[model samples]
Target: MSGLNLKALRKAFGPTEIISGVDLEIADGELIVFVGPSGCGKSTLLRLIAGLESVSAGEILIGGRDVTRVDPARRGVAMVFQSYALFPHMTVRQNMGFGMRVNRVPKAEAAERLQKAAALLQLTELLDRKPAQLSGGQRQRVAIGRAIVRDPQVFLFDEPLSNLDAELRVQMRAELAALHARLGATMIYVTHDQVEAMTLADRIVVLRAGRVEQVGAPLHLYDDPDNLFVAGFLGSPRMNFLTAEVQPDGQLRPLGLDVDLPSPIAGLRPGRRVVIGCRPEHVEIGDGPLAATVKTVEQLGNSTFVHADCAGTPIAAELQERWGTRADAALRLALPTEKTQLFDAETGLRIRQ
Candidate 1:
């Protein structure tokens, strides 16, 4: 499978820019996910790469060949949309074979390719069924099946599971991961769901507004966020943030508490305000230096999360086992120095070692 490259790609609607100068190199056969909030330019970027939207500037290259002006079909890419976009009158087998048929692939060859794709997607049994006769998951698999029959070098997906119910979405996520492994093809998926990005991406391109904010492996970004936006966006319940002041001698005074900024953050000037962030899982019930009120407790069987007020700041701390912390009570907690993350309050950049 071949990969794709975007060189300083930009898109604009009149005076407003939607995707600003993005330069990306997707490794061949890699699975990359584009994730961010709505209107962040993720889907627009995908569409740009697919040739659905023209690039306002720069070039798009697939497999090292420039294809900025080439048609999407000629660029060797297939797209799966949020809506299945299958023909109501066409059977599963016909939908999967549609592209080949359009390209004038012989009926015999198209049939052969469709058969293989349907089998891989476990849709062989439903080949005779129309879209209305299939389950949600089966219909989605059929959509993927159609893409597979094209045997394109890159598969582009734009929130393909957003239409499904919660339970089916979870199951389809797993199935799609398995499909990628089996096909060993490069796939570019766009979604606003952080969980989907974290689980499915070999690397995630986190976008904010019109440009790429950060791109890295899921855990790497989770463990070492580049800025406050990324730190806050990737994890569930999000990371906790507190206003702090840098005192003389480069010390950090978190609200209602006094402590020196750790050595990793000593570069920031003293007398500057900063933002301190820590994931809920990083905050623990131990003897450290943070405090909060137990506002509520959520027990999700395997893991428990405690939402508490830390000196007027709502903070969440995780407990491995259930704890008896009732609401409206003081709770002492620890923010393990290494586990805690700090950001420049004004710039929102992570302070690193």
Candidate 2:
């Protein structure tokens, strides 16, 4: 429906800046996710876009119109918050149609919108039920349905599934994806859960502190991160980092193991300290130059995660097969040259070739 733009967007409380200058263009009908750790300004940014928080300095354009100072109700956007925020006394039908009623929509139009949203969210059968009678997932659906009836140009979800159980969260995630596809509405979602961002977003905007670190398709950012933080943050079990020093012949010595640099990096000089990174899946076990002591073994049913200590450096490796390996056992691990990443130790930036 509508594309959203932030030009030098910023927000501050008192003298402390919470959202720094951020510029992003979200295409019409695109589902963009803002992901980061707690207190990383993801929620602040979302609130700013919703007009719930005043912008400290910057411009917000929605559907090509400047709405930086517009009222929240007039911004053509609807928000589903972490809490359901439903009126316990109101039935699903009444709650979903409350906004329409407040806006003086025609009775017939409001009824029609309610029916359509209920049917779309599979809440048609629960219209007469109150929030107290509904399950967590059902209540969340009611909240989303309320937003849907508004027919907003953009939809903002602020960790809407965080309150649900693990199984319900997974179910709701799939349902949300389906709903997005059906409506084709522009959506901005904020979450600290990287799994949610990876599975739900058309593109992910990774944030830290109050600044955007990287914005791209999920896999793109995962495979080609621009900095060490992005690489370490996006993956489960996280990437393994080992301190190393560059040798004259493009080789690196990490933890008494010699590994050739993955690629030629510009500005890399001999004796420069660098960090070598390898994902769990890329760390081959049972055969390589690096010797480690197994610290822990996690049996995840289908796969195993081996955490080891190599000369005081911790490393984890994922194995397709179940290993009978126990703690305190010695193992050799290898870091494949093609799969390894190099980073500047001082700057925590990727050493680009």
- On lDDT, the leading prediction is 2
Write model 2 residue lDDT over 1-353, tens digit each, in one string. 79999999999999999999999999999999999999999999999999999999999999999999999999999999999999999999999999999999899999999999999999999999999999999999999999999999999999999999999999999999999999999999999899999999999999999999999999999898988999999999999998888877767877466455443354578899999888999999867888899999999999999999998899999999898777999998888888988889999999877
For residue 32, what is the lDDT in candidate 1?
A: 99
The prediction achieving the highest TM-score against the true structure is: 2
Question: All candidates: CA RMSD in angstroms?
Answer: 1.5, 1.4
| Model 2 clashing residue pairs (backbone) | none
On residues 25-60, what C-alpha lDDT tens digit does candidate 1 reach at each position? 999989999999998999999999999999899999
Candidates in order have lDDT scores of: 0.89, 0.93
**How many steric overlaps are in each model, in order?**
3, 0
Instruction: Tell me the lDDT of model 2 at 338.
Output: 83
